[model samples]
Target: VEAPNQTIAIEQSQSDRSKKTFHPVKVDLPGDQITKVTLGRLHFSETTANNMRKKGKPNPDQRYFMLVVGLYAVSQDQFYLLSANVSEKIIVRASNPGQFENDSDVLWQRGHVPETIVYHGRVGINTDAPDEALVVCGNAKVMGRVMHPSDSRAKQNIREVDTNEQLRRITQMRLVEYDYKPEFASVMGIKNTHETGIIAQEVKEFLPQAVREVGDVACNDGEKIENFLMVDKDQIFMENVGAVKQLCKLTNNLEVRIEELEQWNRKLARLKRMSSLKSTVSEESKVSRCSRATSLLPSKKSVPLKSNKVKLCSVKIFRVTIIALIAIMALCALTISTLCLLSVHDRHFEKHPIYRQVVELVTSSSVALSPSTTTAALQGESTISQSTQPVSRIPEVNFCDILPCDKVYCCPIHLQKVKFLNYEKTNAKEKRSRCHCINCNFIMLLSKISEIIKKKTLFLIFLGIDTTISSIQILETQQSIDSRYCSKNLQCRSGNYTYVIPINKYTPMDVEISLEINTTEPLIIFLCKVTFGNYCSPYSSSQNSRKDFLETTQGRQHIWTLPVAKLYDSAYYFRVAVPGFASCSTDPYFAGIFFTDHYFYFYRQCN
Candidate 1:
């Protein structure tokens, strides 16, 4: 906060006024005071404490402290004391700031700080450029310095990674670009031998349990880096990717074939049950056999001459044997599968993000604890092996459109609990809107934001404003999940893992500007996305007029170009239209505001 000044009779300070200010006086500078500082200003909250209370301790009584950091253009040696009324010392600093080649002009707002320190100074640098490392701590004596990284104090020089094992792996790589791919190589390369020695000492506690887990799974360390630096469309990279996809597909097909074979076994089982020997016995067969003994035709009178004994013909067992053979084959397949999955978990395979996510979901489902309260994410495991499980689709999420701004032309539909309502008339004058959280059961916060454009529109009353925005790109993904069927084989998801959007060609940029959408039971959604930058428009804004938009339609992507003239600041921002009743978020519908060029800005705004 700012220190007290003579705004009571404000005037240009005389040199003597500054000269007379060499007093270490005390002043009660209110913490709530708003000051015109070099940085963008924000108020300090009175309710929050400077320090957190211990686990069970009661909050301390409220007390306030006064502090200020200000600058003046007097002499470089100028100093400022606390105001003549308070007991706190004031900090004043002015410097001809040093320049860094990579320095950005952006100023960021600071928030809460947890760490406490007495006082320390540190500086590290490289000839290349200075890093913008911002660290804020609270309630501590602070001091800082800047230095370069190229210093070769013998102890400060950078070193290369040269572990003997790493070297051997390096030899194995036929790298087109001759680079190492070990996960630790880069981390170790910049460190000197001393650092390597330290790391090696802790190998048992920190290093990988398996080589596959340690290096890039498909290749050794040096080879990993070599392939990493190789040219695009490199034969090795293509083969590797092809191999992975083929493996995944192959596993899925194997599951399906197992299920089909099992079904066939069931059919054979039914045939054997119906073809039982007892059931197949016929009266005619018995009669013919009795009469076949030629003399047996006179059996009624020939009893006295009966030979030893009449042996009953044995019934042949045919179908039961066939059924048993089929069952045994099924059992053998099952046993082989169990053994395969019993193998170790490989880093190359299990380390995949999607695979991990799947495993997490499955573990949560199979456990006693409910998923809602669990924050379980699979982390750091060291081994290389494979396990197969059927992938299942998660439950769908419901989505709805957000309410338009409080304008005369807005459709005025706000989500209520499972319903939509129009409060445009009753709450027309209110600044903050109170709407139903929509069908999605979350608050739809509303506030008015200012949008002032200077250009005049062709229609005297209308200024040229296009409120178009990109539609939320939706996708449907089907995955096989039933354990009973999946347990039989991994190939069960033959055509089940199809993408909703059958992309003609997947581009790097296309994949980057993407997000999964919302879905319930039937419809699945994915957002066409851009990162938090200047390339896209905002889907929702607190400050912008919606009435400026001309054409409002459905089933198409809307774009608007915000030209240089339309921009109010170098970091100008625009909002995307929040579709009515579309349980939507700024993230899914908004590409965000990134300025690649004046032309790209126009592309989004143009008709």
Candidate 2:
């Protein structure tokens, strides 16, 4: 049949009652504006005997569907062409020319054409997508479960996201205690309950696919709500799976290492047992051979069996040789095993780089400290009882304990507060008004003076002062004087100090002095001259002049070693001098001299 204007043609097949079908309807429209032709469906059973039904709904049993063949934007030169079937359940049939005969009613026939129903317009749920359906084109959220066909293996063009690196990232994700906002909680009716889960923002850094931003218009109040980040439980579950697998692999590696250690221990035990058994066997064999040789000999002084004696000697030699060999072998095996085990232990520690560094640091410190102390004791210039005893260990002291500053270590010696002197800088030149800039005139009269007198002794002079001294002078005399010990000519003629290396047991009197200098200026250049000697020469005709140590342009703190020659009827002296000293008047600068029990003639102890 031809429609008005000859735009649509419908052809019906004349067939038996058992097999009934209709031909395809061809519609043609010619116009620049009319770019599409939407063919309406016609239900045959609803039609009257002579004409087709119009403006009426079809019966429940009648089958009909309207199909949009093509939609062309003629002005834009664009077309959206689709082919589908219509029934109680909609389906889209694939377009294959000549697959459907002109006489067949493809829509009415069930299971004749493969189809899928596709909506080309916008679809909305709680949210709306202007161009997509089922799930929004932007972001879709399902409050409840979303069921699908159970076909996990249906994925294609897939690349595995499983990796140890991914697992590590997942493990680093922080699980947090959180709750929904009040607005969301009220809508969800979960305000009273506290929730624990990963934060979306935090997880987004590691696994972006697991988190999504979602927003929707409030329906009840028609209020606009802000977008919020939501985490996908499925992605989180996948990450968990990866983490569990990684942990399993790690556990396996640990188990393997443990097994190796256990095996090594078992072997060591076997070796020990074997060695003991061999020793016992050798001893028993020696005893048995001797008894046999004795029984084979005559009880009286008759000629003993020479053969028997020879055999017994051979057996004794063989037994001794075997036992010696076994002992040597056992010792070698033990040494090798011990080295192997130690190597394994070292490797295990090295796997944790930070921990290994800590271990190495502690070990090196212990090694350096103990040897230094022991060497000092051995090199001390005294043969007294105190020298023989172990050097006393003191608790760790911080610089802040003595000064108002951050923690700092002086090192190797206990800093005892002997004396403190404060002063002000009067000029740029030397401060000669006083005998010395910071004179800490304190004598260390050894408590065991009688013992000290019996042998040469070392002493420590701790002096804390505010400014630098131009020169340090030590006066050692036979007799004690109250205030008659200042003279220019009898100054013992000391100069730049160096190690007074003890070449022999009593020649060079070596001493190490450690000093700390702090200046108000950020940088300063100065020469420090430290001298210690005997100014009073009752037994000697000439004064001792030892200028070996020189320190120039030093900032912060420095240590100097001054070695002196042992002289008779002379006492020890110390002095510090600064040529041009410029510093704050109030800030306390520290200077300390320690008489180490050891004469470190070759090395400085403060370093």
**What TM-score does model 2 achieve against the real structure?**
0.28
lDDT of each: 0.28, 0.38
lDDT of prediction 1: 0.28
Which 10 consecutive residues of model 2 have the lowest summed lDDT? 590-599
- Compose the digit string of candidate 2's lDDT tens values, residues 1-607: 2121322223232333232344444445577566554433322322212222255632334322233233233336544444453223221121221222222233233333477444434555444343233443233457998775656698677667666976888778997886655555454444354777788888888788888876653423445566657788887887778788888999998986687567546656776787799899978977787877788678764446666677777878888799889997676566556545544553443333222222222223222222233224323332222322221221111122223443122222442232211112233553343222112111112223344445332211111122232322222211121112221111111221221211111222222223333332122323322222221133322433434445343432333433332221111222232223222121111121211011112222222
List candidate 2 stretches off by more than 4 Å: 1-34, 37-156, 188-193, 216-225, 271-607
**Residue 143 error for model 2, in Å?**
16
Candidate 2 local accuracy as lDDT? 0.38
Question: What is the TM-score of candidate 1?
Answer: 0.17
Poorest 10 consecutive residues of model 1 by lDDT? 595-604
